[model samples]
Target chain A: MTTISIIGSGNMATAIGTRAAKHGHAIELMSRNTAKASALADQIGHGATVAALGATPAGDIVIVAVPYTSAVDVVTHYGDALAGKILVDISNPFNADASGLATTPDSSAAQEIAAAAPEGTPVVKALNSVFGHVLAHDTPLDVFVAGDDAAAKAQVAAFLESIDLRPLDTGGLGMASVLEWTGILLMGLARNGAGFDIALGAEVR
Target chain B: MTTISIIGSGNMATAIGTRAAKHGHAIELMSRNTAKASALADQIGHGATVAALGATPAGDIVIVAVPYTSAVDVVTHYGDALAGKILVDISNPFNADASGLATTPDSSAAQEIAAAAPEGTPVVKALNSVFGHVLAHDTPLDVFVAGDDAAAKAQVAAFLESIDLRPLDTGGLGMASVLEWTGILLMGLARNGAGFDIALGAEVR
Candidate 1:
């Protein structure tokens, strides 16, 4: 079983940790708030445990499930603890008010996180497209994975499949911007009654 | 029958004009290059005709299908001729290399087209997401429509249905930026081997 560490106790982190535990993977939930993380750990049961933010858990995968504004700071706080591990980024940099697209021209939220992580950390982008409701309900949603490391991507793909979700490989790490922007577009579609509950995955005939 | 005036002689203009004609809508192809427009008109056959750029054709809808850089210029050149008509903007402000998204932080290609059109012109955003290959092949594709005018949106929806394409109403003119950004994201997906031939449309079960 692949050991996994989740670096946030928010909705996404909880969803991933619970799903990973259901797949029989060893899981660790880390956060600054010990009570919340411990509570989540209790709820998930199945060998899942809560650890402090700086705890260097021995895991092959680490999922960073923090908000876009605090993603860099969270990654920096984890520092070399994440080095040589497969780091998954699931954040979108869109503004809450829905005025316009919110990332700088030169870089995106995933890229920022990757830059903050220690060298050889192997950052992968995935799971930012599906809604939190779907995540919590364990719906069979499609997940897009993009990263430069083929082995890391394959591992994440296996983990996604274990949760009964379709994992689509969307090429390199640079393609994360497209995946991130797709979330913003989905937000607009949902706000306009186009049904945000829907998740988009490409079908090849 | 709804009269639709298309303001370009490119591949997209031809695809939309041909599909509109197939749907029994009165179609007129307007472009500075009359020869190219006439050739496309000849290809589309029935219920379609080529007209000069300056000619004022009576139509309930005017579609501006041009490149992002030229969309504003085309709308400004048409000026008051499009007054009181439903102006459809199908341009996306993506960089030439298609490496990243490039639009003004506060506005997009659709907003710029709306700003340049004559006063009282109801500008709607549609057909920006559908690929030309998909549009030309007569396959079922999804067309996203957005604008501030309800009646104008209805008219566009009717035209979309007539073409056997799904029309998703994404809401108000401000949302055009979101739709245009989707085009950029789609382009990125296509460039990364996700198939550009696909168009995103919804089906309610």
Candidate 2:
């Protein structure tokens, strides 16, 4: 029953918005390109609305669904408007060629977003590992969430569970690098002949 | 039919040696401590021999199966003897706490090993993703190989195939960063209730 704002109109943004709407969460699809956002919003129907970029919609959670290189730019654009709100980062810092990873030695994409956003704004990293097609189909995908704020992670986890997905809490934001790299490795496996339908799940026996 | 020398008596070294011996390759186990290497060599049996740490055993390939912090020291111990040889680096520059990745932004553990080795020596990065127990159990694990030299990569891939493991060539040495980070990610998964029984495999549909 939470309101969610997605700050992009790409495949990932659409996927998250669609799933969020299906989970009974109100969604605002925001994009720099209004046409693209409106088109997606029109396609997604109920509980979904289209809006222009920099529009501060009423939402409990704001998802930055842009690319890793553009993540900082998107966060900067939002500014203090995102203060005290929950920010979910699902972008992987994959290189331009998609051949490998593109991250700093000690920092991660989520860390960069947390640093860019206003203080006290909870940043949760999740949904980067699941493919867009899989999310669209509502397949059983394991979503790994990592953040300093436990309650914020639990909120995202509850929303994820509502959409028929499982949430694996992978400790604090420092562990976001591991989660981001997992997506990159899975991408490499998929590109080099591994089926994208294959999802990495953990089983403890 | 390449002679390969492994420079550790750890689980990784033993797993590689066992697989190599199964394929009728000449395998030499060397360690700074001779007794442990001798014990491992005895356990592996079948044409595998224990050699002194400084001894440059005649081998077409030398795999450095040590920790990231110890890789440079081990390579330096072998000195100019590693010239023109194919040195395989299977180490990831992850912190001891396994919470953070510790490699240069542009470089990786494989690159560091290549730089530490003598000039003209080819270094291939592989086996960082597969677990030691999976290696010992001869499970179907995918090993991603990357290096600057195609010939060296081909040689390493051939060796990997002979060991009954699938080798996926993930392009040049720059891609080694992703491969190394895969291990770090897997470690996180393993620590967080994910068992080591899971192996990452890639296949074309």
Candidate 3:
């Protein structure tokens, strides 16, 4: 079982942590709200622990589950503490009203987080395209991932597989921008006709 | 059966024309190259006829099956001839190497074509997310459509349904930009690992 550290106590963080924990993986909850973090850890059970916001994460894979605006800041604050760790960025840079992305193709949230992260820290973008509640459900969903490092993507894919989620790698970190757009597409679909429970999948025909 | 007028004798035109004809829809092929358009019409069969490039399209729904760069020009040239007709924009504003979109979200190919069309012309963006060959296949695939006019979008959705394709309306014309990025995402998925035979679908779970 792998140790998965989530840096936020929000909906996404809780969903991913709970699922990972249910899959026999240890979850290290790191949040500025100590009480909330501790409560989340207790709720997850199975040896789940709470870590300080800026402390070195115990998990090999660190998921920055914060908002898009704070993702880079969180990584920068972690500094060298995140060195050699696989940083997973699941932030969607949606503009106001969710019509378009706040970040451009040149500087997606994952790209910005990678820039702020310490050297040797491999940052992967996953779980950004699916809704938090859908992910919370115990169903196999397609998770599109993008990262420059091959081994880092493989690790994230393996973790997703362990949680009964299918991972579809969409190429290097540059494609992370496309994944962000995909999040917007999902929102558009949900708001229009496809509804919120729908997930995007690749059908071989 | 709808009379589908396709303005281009390219890969997309052939794919869409052949499929529409097989579904009992009459196809009117219009292209700068007379020989190529006639050849495509003959290949499509079922009374598929060739029309002059600038002539009023014989079909109620005129699909501008040309490159992104030439879509607006073609619409502008059609001018009042396209008035009161449903225009479908299936061009992907893909930048060189397909790494990024050539058009920004503010001015997608659909929006540009809409702006250049006659006052009553309703330009709907569809068939941009999937590959041409996939559309040529017999299997039903999800077709995402975007348009500002509800009636026009309904017509396009009905056309897609008649041809055994599911239509998912994203939203207004603004969502067309998201659909453009989705094209890039599909290319990324194909080039990375998913292969070219895959189609993006909305899985309700």
lDDT of each: 0.78, 0.81, 0.91
Error of 3 at A19 (Å): 1.1
lDDT value, residue A73 of candidate 2: 92
- Model 3: per-residue lDDT, tens digit, B84-123? 8999999999999998888865789888898899886888
Q: What is the DockQ score of candidate 2, to 2 decimals?
A: 0.25
Q: Provide the lDDT at B136 for model 1.
A: 82
| Regions more than 4 Å wrong, model 3 | none
**DockQ scores for all predicted structures:** 0.36, 0.25, 0.82
Tell me, by lDDT, which candidate is best: 3
lDDT-wise, the better of 1 and 3 is 3
The CAPRI quality class of candidate 1 comes to acceptable
lDDT of residue A200 for candidate 3: 92
Model 2 chain B poorest 10 in a row by lDDT: B196-205
Candidate 2 or 1, higher lDDT:
2
The segments of candidate 1 whose C-alpha lies over 4 angstroms from its true place after superposition are: A148-151, A169-172, B202-205
Error of 2 at B44 (Å): 1.5
Specify the highest-TM-score model's number.
Answer: 3
Q: Give interface RMSD, per candidate.
A: 3.2, 3.7, 1.0
Highest DockQ model number: 3
lDDT score for residue B23 of model 3:
96
lDDT of 2 at A137: 75
Q: What is the lDDT of candidate 1?
A: 0.78
| Runs off by more than 4 Å, candidate 2 | A1-3, A19-26, A51-59, A76-84, A94-104, A129-138, A161-168, A182-205, B1-3, B22-26, B195-205
